[model samples]
Structure formats: structure tokens, C-alpha cells
Target chain A: MSEPIVVIRGVEKWFGGLRALGPVDVDLKPGERLGLIGPNGSGKTTLINCLSGLFVPDKGTIVYDGRDITREPAFRRARMGIARSFQIPRPFTGMTVLENLLVPMDYLGSHERSELERADEVLASVGLAARRDAPAESLSQLELRKLELARALVTEPKVLVADEAMAGLSENEIDDVLALLMRLNDTGVAIIMIEHIMHAVMRFSQRMICLETGRIIAMGTPQDVAQDRQVQKVYFGERAGA
Target chain B: MRTLPFLVIAALILVGGLFLPQFVGNPYYFFAGYVVLQYVVIATGWNILGGYAGYINFGTSAFFGAGVYVAAFLIKAFGAPLPVQILAAGVVGMLLGVATGYLTLRIQGVYFSIATVALVVVLETLIHNIDYLGGASGMQTIAPPAPAWFGGQTQYVFCAMLVLAVVAVVAARFIERSWIGRSLRAIKASEPAAEACGVPTLSMKLVACAISGAIIAIAGAPYAYYASHVDPLSAFSLTIGLNALAMPLIGGTRSWIGPVIGALLLASVQQIATVTISSEFNILAVGIVLIAFVVLAPEGILGLIADLKEKLRRRGARP
Candidate 1:
């Protein structure tokens, strides 16, 4: 509606002459849910990396909150309210679950309440309050994902880009993560969901966009995109045929 | 199993030092004791980058040698006070640490460690070939006001202990509670994930290196003056780099007490063995002990204690 919270214009990225992703344009408004579904090597993760400042696109610019962040370092971008959780949870193995949250909370010094309280609350938000004292190594698959989310949440981010928060999980586990994303989105935080879990992304996303060969081939309501001939031929044809 | 045993050993050293006068009415034991305490600072400093962040820095000699030189040059040239000289160690160490961190932190683990080793060599050559401040022949580092004011060896011991006390307390507090410590732990576990979380991994690595270097340099300042000698061979010696790491591993780099114990035990052995063995054997003994410890106890003495404690706990003794 208003100025998009994130604007990616004509973004082109390449890895050693392999034109991985490209000259694409997308805008995400505040609190909007974006479901980015793409076939393997379709550059979904590559695009997310560009948006999160992991890799600078060779061409085009990234504008966030009325500022061009093309040259800002990843940490500076994070401090400026951008947070992303890895596909595989990386919970600083030596620290407790509570300590993982504390790392990002340090930037909130004098800007909020005590770090310990904020850390505990974030742990609670991710349903990890019970495991607050547990070493990150001891956490199970679901718990590690929760810890990852808690770590990002503690940054009090405007955008939370989760790269495959639910992968290789059972149906029940998928529901658990979907519910968590829903709760995060409900809190007025924009979420960029990059997932291969089709049904989960379709059900959870307010809108869905599908990619094929690093190009956005289909973008519409979940049903419309799913029924679209291009998506069906590329995605469902492979999975269904397999 | 971690640093606890080292604390007990340091206590024993303190108690024995109090009773040492009955054996010799001189400052010899105090001087040796000062070296051990200073190593505690050095090893702890090295561990912030080496053990905590999982980045090995053999360039500790650079910081130690730098401090000794700075202190000597200041006191010799401008007659700067003792406090100012100590501050110089920290400032210069941190600055050098930043350079090392920036250049090497982005590389892999072994490369970073090799960079440090090479850094020591490059820095040593630069200083050894230089002309001012006594060159390779070295300068005599002057004693601070403590021994002169209180007028005895005991006061010097007191001063060394004071520095050790502050260093240990500050180190323990930071590594346990501070934000920098947590980020370091993250980097240690997984750098890619840490970067994804916006850790500024490179900067943090350098900051750790700098602080570690600064502390080691400051610790070496008084030690140089206590010995009243600062040769490039002694201060920037590769052996100093080796000894700095030995203690942290033996005592259990996981905790604050590990390096302290490692330093004290090895120092005590060296001190006692000096009476029976030659000076050349002292450094050789360090290498031997490190090798023996590495072979016999991969987890170090603290890890051994932890294994024993677990056994005792299972046997219901811990209750």
C-alpha cells in the first residue's frame, strides 16, 4: 500500500558466468507474507541471500525503509532490522538456548529492557522456554528450528526471512512450523518464506510465487499458481511423475 | 575439570610463596612467581582468539615483545610513568590485533594460525634489524614504582599479584557474561551460520585477537622489567608462543582456570628443574611436557579430572 518495506529492482546475480538469478523485480510491503517457491537451483535461496545482504547482486539495488542498502555489510543490515534464519539451525553450539537470543539482544542496549528478560521472552515466543538452560547441541530437530527462530526474533526484525524452516519434517512437524510462522506474521512482522514444502507454503502464504530456472513463471493465489500450466508442467509433473 | 584445579594450584603457589623465605632470603622465587602469574595473563589472552573463537594466534610473542619494547622505549626516552607504559601495551596490542584479525580472520583455521606464526617471524625480523632502543642487543626494562616505594621484593610480588588478580577477574567476567563472548562461541561452532545471523564475524575475530594481544602485552611489561632484560631472542622468541598455548590446553581451555594451572605447574617444574637442569633444557622441557600431555591426556589435566569426577558422581561420592 504505502512505500514497500523492501524493494528489489532489476536485481541480477551470477556465480562465475552461470547467470544464476536475475534482473528480477519484487516489492514486499510491511507485514506482508511472501511465499517464494522454486524448483531446486531455481535461485530462491540466491535471491533471499541478495535481499538479506549475504551476497550483493552484480546489478540493481536493494532499497529498505527508504534507504539504499546495496553496499551495507550484512551485520549493519541486521542492526538496521533485517534477520534471516539458516536452513539448518545454527545455535552457537556451546551456548545455552537463552544465550543464543542474548547475542542479538546486545544491540538493543539502552533501547529496551534487560537482556535476560528479553531473551527469556523470545525463548518463550518460540516455545523454547522449557529448554532455556539446555545447550544448543542437546536440542532435537524441532527444537533447533525453534532456537533459530528465537535467535532471529530477538533482533526485533522488521523482516524475518526463513530459508526452509520446515524441511524433512513429518506432517505434524510441518504444522508446528506453519503455526509458528503464522504467529510471527500475526505480530505484524513481515516474513519471507522460502520453502520446498509445497502444501505448507501454499497454505501458509498470503500469496505465492513460483520460480523456474531463476525466473518467476507464476505468481498468484495458491490455487491459481498451482493450476497454472507452467507450474504444473515443471513442479507437479516432476513430483507426480516421480 | 576445566579451570578449577588450576585455581587450587595457584592457591598452593600463594601459600608456598609465603613460606618460601625459610629456604632463600632473596627475591629469586618472587621473580619466578611473577613469570608464572604473567603467563596466566598471556595464555588467557591467547585463548580468547585461540581457544574461545577457535582461531589459533601464535603471534602472542609479538604483543609481549611489543609491550616490553614500548615500556622500555617510553621509560628510557620520555621517562613516562609505569602506568602509562602498561596502557601502551594494551593500546598497541589491540591495534596489532586488529590488523591480524582483518588480514587472517576471513581465511580458514589453519591459515589464520599460520598467519600468526608468520606474523611473529616478520615482526621479529623488523625489530631485530632495527637500530633504535638497543636493537638485537636489547634494552634493560626499568622496574615500576612498587618495589621502589614499598622497598622490598614482597611489594613486587604484591604488584604482580595485583595485576594477575585484575586480569583474571576481568577475563572471567567477560568470557562468561558479555555479548562478545557469545558471538565468539557462535563463530567457533559455525562461521557461515554466524554470518547469516549478522555477526560481523571478521570484525569480532579481530576484536578478540586485539584484546587478547593487548592483555598479553600488558602482562609481559612488568615481567620484562622484573628480569631487567629485553632481547629480541627472549621477548619475541618462538618458544614464548609455544609456552603460551601449552597451559591453556593442559588446564582445559574451556574455563578460566585452565591456563592459570597450565602456567603454574609448568613454571613450577621449570623453576625447580632449573636447580637441577640447565637453562637450555628449560625450553626443551616445555616442549616435552606439551607433547606428553597431548599424548597421554588429549583433553588435558582438567578433562582427566572431569572424567574422574563423573566416575565419582556415578559412584555416589558427589552427593
Candidate 2:
């Protein structure tokens, strides 16, 4: 493939003296579907935080789109086309659903179409056209997830970091989000999906990485990593004495 | 509403307000009206940061008292006119606001509120020690002659306060309608989410704090002339802070109209209470009404009206 769109190297993060994440490395290729799976406290979210400019790594560098972004602010990274969805849906309350999409559009004012047209297009793509005018507080759980994704997609980011975007969603809802991500990737948008749902991530990710306690335990094609001994142990609790 | 139409309506209201002294000849009317309009400016200013940006500022007295003293200083030092005093006070208040926001905005929620209260204490102590601007004792201010049209000092200051009220309300409306308002609402909803969406949350907050401080200071600028005396105790009185917060909550925090409705209602009630009952009942009255609104219609009058309208619309649609 062409040069990786994102290159993360030797990133480390510590909350006080406790090393919560990193001393790890990662690289994301253009239009690639990268799945990151780990158990609770496994530093998946921590890594995403470091990558998205929320928490600058105590050590190491994050180069994005051919520039070093390790010290960049979160908003600056977002403007440079790094977008993310929160694990919990954070709809700008008091605004309507369509207006929620318009929030990001106000900042990234480089879109070809007007904000209204772009917002409408995003809402329709996420299957929320009918609920466009509804207040954000009135959305159901599944709809809120769609809104989270729609907001991330609205910026037209080259890389979308979806942190637990499908968590707590039903089986069919998972498939719905998977299809949305697939369709988005088809349009040349790379996605890094941090998910706890096993089967869904396995299906969506072309390549996968399994993290355990801030360290990468396995990385390769989905089948290879799923069957890797360490990943299996981490997922299934030592697999009945091997 | 569009910008031009909004400004035109604001001008019309201001012109109509200037005629109030003509209809009511009593000096007491202008006195009470001035206090009420002062609350209008303070509440609207406080709402820009407190209601829209979701940062509770418990230090209204800090900005207000600073404005009062700034005006007093300008008058005593340079024999400055009202407009110059107002302009100087606004600049000082805005600087204080940015300084406060820069130092404390990283700490969210109650911590931010607590830091603001500490700011009031710090500024009050500093002013108490400064001898030039009256110190612990008070300073008296004599007003310049009123304009030929206004006919009296109280009436003149009342019209000046009315103009500031219009300016404050119009500025608040402009903020509530613009992209800054949208970003502030987003920040209020979730700061991290707003940041992730490419909104500079801290800078947006600083802008809100600056504008809020300037308007609030402008309200306090004419006060030294109105009261004819400025003292640390009364200038930095806790009542102003409480009333500023209460008015916005009573009216609703969602839009510009909420604080205006709230300030008018609550300030009018307090005025009536001070006159009919006693000066002691003023705080008691605000306390009771605030508790009632907080427990019952927490969204203030606007939210209540919107809910009522929604219920009525739903009913009408059903049959």
C-alpha cells in the first residue's frame, strides 16, 4: 500500500506514576479498517486518546498526514481531519439532530456544499433523515450511536476513530453500523474501530490488533490474530488450562 | 430575527424608554426603574456565560464592584464624563474576566464556581486596602449636570442605563444567534465532544467571559453617580451576585429573552417588596421566589411557556 496516513511510535502515557498506556507503536494505512480489541483496563481507549490528541503521550511521536502532531491540541487535530466519536453519545443538547451535524461544519468551513446541504446529506446517509428535526435529547440508544457516527463522518475526515461506537447496540444494530463503516471505507475514509463486541470487529476489520494492559499482544489479519495464543488467552481467560 | 430588524426594534424600544420620565414625574419611579434596568444588564451579561456556556459565575459583585470603583477613579482623578467612565470600566472588567478565565477555566463544574468566588474575595480585599479609590471607608460622587432633555441626574442616568440595557440585550441576542452561540452550547453540553468537533472550547469560554464581564461592568459604571456613594461593603454586596444568578434561572437560560423576562419580573417584585414591606424583606422575597422556581419550574418562565404551548399544540392536533 501507499505510505501510511498515520504513524504512531513508542507512545507512552502515565496517570501519575501508573503507566496506563503505551511504549507502543501503530501505523494506519489509507482507507484501512483497523480493529482494536482489548478487555477492560486494557488501554484501548487510552491509545485512542493519545492518537486523537486528547492525551498527549508522555513519550514518543504521532505523525499524521506527513506532520508531527504529538503536541497538537485536540481541536487542531480535528481540523486536520482527525475525527472521533465518544463511547457515550454526546449530542449537543438543545440543538436539533440536523443542527448537531452543523456544529462541526461551522469550524471546518471548506466543504463544497452549504452547511445545510452537507448536514442533510450526512443525516440521510446515516438513516436519520426522518429524525433530522428532532431534538438530540429525544433520540433512542441506536439513533444516538448513528448520530455519533454521523457527526464523525460530517467532517470528511481521512481517519475516523470510533471508540466503542457499537457498544451496547443489539445484534442487528451492530450489523447496521458495520455496514455504515464499510460503505464509508468504500468512499476512501479509514476507520479505527475500538470495540468490545467480538464477532462484529472480527467481521469489519481487515487487519486487527489486540492490546493487553498498554502493550500490543498480537497484530495481523483477523484470523491470525484471533487464533494467536496470547489473544485467545486474553479473551477467553486461559482457555481451560490450554 | 435578522440583524437589521433586531437593531431597529431595539432602537425603537430605547426611544420609547426615553419617554418614561415624561409620563411619570416622580423621582422614585426613575430610581426604581434604574435599579430594575441595572438588573436587566447584569442578568443578560451573566446569562451569556452562566446560562449559555454553563459556567456558573458566583462573582458578579467582583465585576460590578470593579466597574463602580473604576468609574469612581476616573471621575475623581480626571473629572471624566459618564461615557468615559463606562468605557474605562468596561476595559478593566474585560481584562479581569480574561485573567480569571485563563487561570481557572481548566477546572470545570463546581471548582470553576468556587474559583470565581475566591476571585471576588481577592479583589474585595485588594480594593479594601487601596486608599485612592476610597478604601474601607466610602467616597462620595457628585453628578455632572443632566442634559437639557433629561431634566435631572436620576433621569439622565436612568436613560443611560436604559441604553446600556439595550446594548447588552442586543449583544446577547447576537451571541445567541451566531456560530459562537452554537459552539458555546456545544461546550456547555460536553467540552470534550466540542473539542473533538473542532471547537476551541477554552477560547470560546474566554470570549463569553469577556463579553459578559464588559456588559456587567457597563451596568455598574453609572452606579456611583446613581447612589452618590461607593463603598466596599455595598459595592461588593452579595445580593447583586445572588440576584444576577437568580434572574437568569427564573427567566430560563436557553435564550436571551429568559434573563430579560426574569430580571423584569424578579426585580419588579423586589422593588415592590422594598417599598411596600420593608428593605429587610428584599432578600427574603428573592430567596423564597428563587427556591420556588428552582423546585417547581427550574427551566424558568420560558421553559414553562414552551411546555404549555407544546401541550396545547398536541391537544389541538389530537382532535
Candidate 3:
């Protein structure tokens, strides 16, 4: 795949001797759809944090676009074309939905006229044109999630890490987010989706990897990973039992 | 075209201020007017960082007091003119602000506030032990003779403060409509989210700190000349700190007009209370008003007005 967009080698993170995530390796190619699923406490969020420069991994390195960014600050990483949406939507309160998108666009040092145009385009793409002028605090749950996605997209990141973008959505809403991710991926941006919704992940991911206790236990095609004895015993078995 | 009306109004205010001494006849007018204008500067300055960036600064007196001391030192050593002193004070204030922000802003939220409070104590102590600056006592500063164009020393300082107030308000208004203001609001809403979205949060915060510090300190510079005395106690008074925070909150921190409205209203009331009741009663009044605004109008007068407008629009739509 034309020079992996992001390469993670021997990444490990620990919180006071309790290893949260680590000794993990991942490579994301351009336009790749990678689904990352793990049980709770499997360090899914921790890995994403490391990738996005929120927390420096205790060991190993993260190379993005052939550059080592293991120690870069989150803002610098974002400027280098890495963007992510929060599992819990964090719209900038006291601002209109369009203004929320404009924040990142402004940071890009774009012209004021173009920034406004870009903000409009992003809002329209997210199906939030009607609510463009509404205060972020006034948005419904679904709209807030869409606003989060729009804010991420405004930066035009090369890699988008969607951390549970469909966490609390209804069945149809889940499909809607899945389709949106697919469309976004089609734009030549690699996407790492960490989701608990199994069917959505299975249908969206070109390849699936399951993590457990800071370790990758299974990695393969949807059917191959699902039918594997270790994967079913550890991941699907726990879901079925619950 | 949009700015024409604002520029015209500003010019009228300046011209009217130039002739204010002609009619008032009372030296007391300039004296009281000077105090009101001083709060205008302080409140507007405080709002830039506290309101826009959501970083509550409990050490307003530190920057203000630094300016007072900087001016006092210059006067005592080199017999610096008022203009020179004001400039020096702004620089010192900006430096202290940047230093304090660099050290404390990393901690963020309430912890950052506590660090500011600590800064006040540290600065006050440092100034107290310095005998050249009068230590705990104070130094008397006889300002250079007022310019021939002004009638008296009080009038000169009053005009100086008027110029500063206008400049501070104009600067604040410009910032409110700029990208810097939007970034600050984003940081205020959610620092982590703002960072993830590519805002250099620390750098933006430091810029806010420097501007806020410089403007507030500029306000204190004239006080050194007006009062003709400078002491650690009054220079670093906690009342100034509290009032600085209270005025912006009471008015509305979002726009420059809020602090202007708040400082004028609050300072006028305090002036009246100080004369009719007692000087001590002024503090009590400020405390009461601050609490009332915090509880009843958290967004200050501006937020309340916005809410009322929304309600009226809803009513109109329903009918």
C-alpha cells in the first residue's frame, strides 16, 4: 500500500504500573478502513491517544507520513494532518454550530472569506446546514455528534481517528454514521474506527483487529477473525455470555 | 461604512472630554472621573483573559501593583516623565503577566487561579522588603508639572486616563471580532478539544496574558501620579483585585461594552456610597453587587439581554 500513512511499532502505555496499552504494532495505509474493537479496559482509547499525541507512549514510536511524531504536542500533530472526534461530543459551547467548525479552519490560517465558505461546506456535508446558526449547546445528541465530525473534517486531516463516533446512536443512526465514514474514507483519508457496534464495524472495516488486555488477539478479514476459535472464545464468547 | 458611526462617536467623546474642565469648575470632577476611567481600563483588561480565555485571574493586583512600582522606581531614580513612566509600567506588567501565565497556565482551571493568588502574595512580599521603593511605608511622587494645554495636574491626568479608556475599549472591541478572540473562546469552552482541533492553546493564552497585563498596568501607572503616593498596601490592595474581576462579570465579559457599562455603573455607585455612607461601605456594596450578578445574571447584562430578546422572538413567532 503506497507507503503506510501511519506506522506504530512496539507502542506501549502504562498508568502507574498497570499497563493500559502497549507492545502493539499497527500500520494504516492511505484510504484504508481499519476497525479496532476491544473489550472494555483493552486500552483502545489509550492507543488512539498515543496516535493523536495526547499521551506519549511509555515505549516504542509512532511514525506518521514518514515522520516520527512520538513526542509532538497534540496541536502540532493536528497541524500535521491528524484529527479525531471525541467519543463524548465536545462542541465549543456558546458558539454557533458553524462557528465551531470555523475554529479549526481559522487555526489553519486560511483567508476569512474562504474560512467561512469552508465552514458552510462542512456544515452542509454533515447535513447540519439548517442548524448552522444554532448555539452548540442547543443541538440535539445526533446533531452534536455530527458537529463533532464536522469540526474534525474542517481541518482536512490525512488520517481521521473516530473514537466511538456512533456510541449512542439508534440502529439507523449507526448505519448513517457508517456510511458517512465510508464516504469520508473514499476521499483518500485513512480512518481508524474504534467502535463497539459489531455489525457496523464488520460491514465498514476492510480489515478487523480485536484487542484484549493491551494486546492484539486477532487480526484478519471479517469472516476469518469472527470464525477464529481464539477470537470467538475471548471476544464473541464474552458478548454472547453477557 | 460600518465603522464610521463608531469613529464619529469616539471623536465626539474625546472632544467633549477636552472641554470637560471648562464647565465642571470643580477639581473634584476630574478626581472622581479619573477613578472611574481607571476601572474602565482595569475591567476591560481583565475581561480579555478572564472572560475570553476562561482563565480566572485572582492576581489582578499583582500586575497593577507592578505598574505602580515600576512608575514609582522610575520617578524616584530618573525623574521620568509621566509618558515614560506609563510606558515602562506597561512593559513590566506585560513581562510579569507572561511569566505568571507560562508558570501557571500549564496547570489550568482552579489550580491556575490559586497560582495567581500566590503570585500576588509573592510580589507584595518582594516589594515590601525593598527599602528603595519605601518598603512597607511608601514613596511620595510629585508628578512633573502638567502640560500648559491642561489647566491643572488633576485635569492632565484625567485627560490621560480618558485617552487610555478609549484606547482600551477600542482594542478590546477589535479583539472581540478577530480570530484571536474566537480561539480564546474555543479554549475557554474546552481546552483539550481546542488543542485537538489544532489551536496552539498555550501560545494564544500567553498573548492574552501579555495584553491583559499591559493594559491593567497602564491603568495603575497614572494612579501613581494622581495619588502622589505609592505603598505596597494600597498599591497591591485586594479591593482592586476583586473589583477588576467583578466589573467585567457584572457588565458582561463577552464584549468590550460590558466592562465599560459595568465599571461606569459600579464605580459611580461606589463614589456616591463613599460620600454619603462611609468608605468601608463601598466594599460592602461591591461585594453585594458582585454576588447578585453572579447568581441572577451569570452572563452579565449582555447575556440577560440576549435571553430576553430570544423570548420576545418566540412570543412573536407563536402569535
True contacts kept of each: 0.59, 0.76, 0.66
For model 1 the interface RMSD, in Å, equals 1.6
Q: Write the per-residue lDDT of candidate 3 for residues A75-146, one digit (tens) a residue.
A: 999989999999898889978898888788887876668778888887888889999999899998888889
- Give the DockQ (2 decimals) of all models: 0.52, 0.86, 0.78
Question: What TM-score, over all chains together, does every model reach?
Answer: 0.87, 0.98, 0.97
- Candidate 3, B243: how far from true, in Å? 0.6
Clashing pairs in 3: A12-A22
Give lDDT tens digits, candidate 1, residues A79-181.
8888898887777887788777777776567425576787888888778999999878899999998888888888789999999998777889889888988
lDDT of 3: 0.90
RMSD, one per candidate, in order:
4.0, 1.5, 1.6
Off by over 4 Å in 1: A110-115, A240-242, B1-24, B78-82, B139-158, B161-165, B195-200, B278-285, B288-319
Score residue B9 of candidate 2 by CA lDDT.
91
Q: Per-residue lDDT tens digits of candidate 2, residues B179-219?
A: 89999999999999999999999999999999999988888
- Residue pairs in collision within model 1: none
The whole-model lDDT of each prediction reads: 0.78, 0.92, 0.90
lDDT at A235, model 3 = 79
Writing each residue's lDDT as its tens digit, candidate 2 over A1-242 gives 69999999999999998999888999999999999998899999999999888898999999999999999999999989999999999999989998788889889774456867888988999999999999999999999999998988898999999999998888999899899989999999989999988789999999999999999999999999888888888876666356
Clashes of each: 0, 0, 1
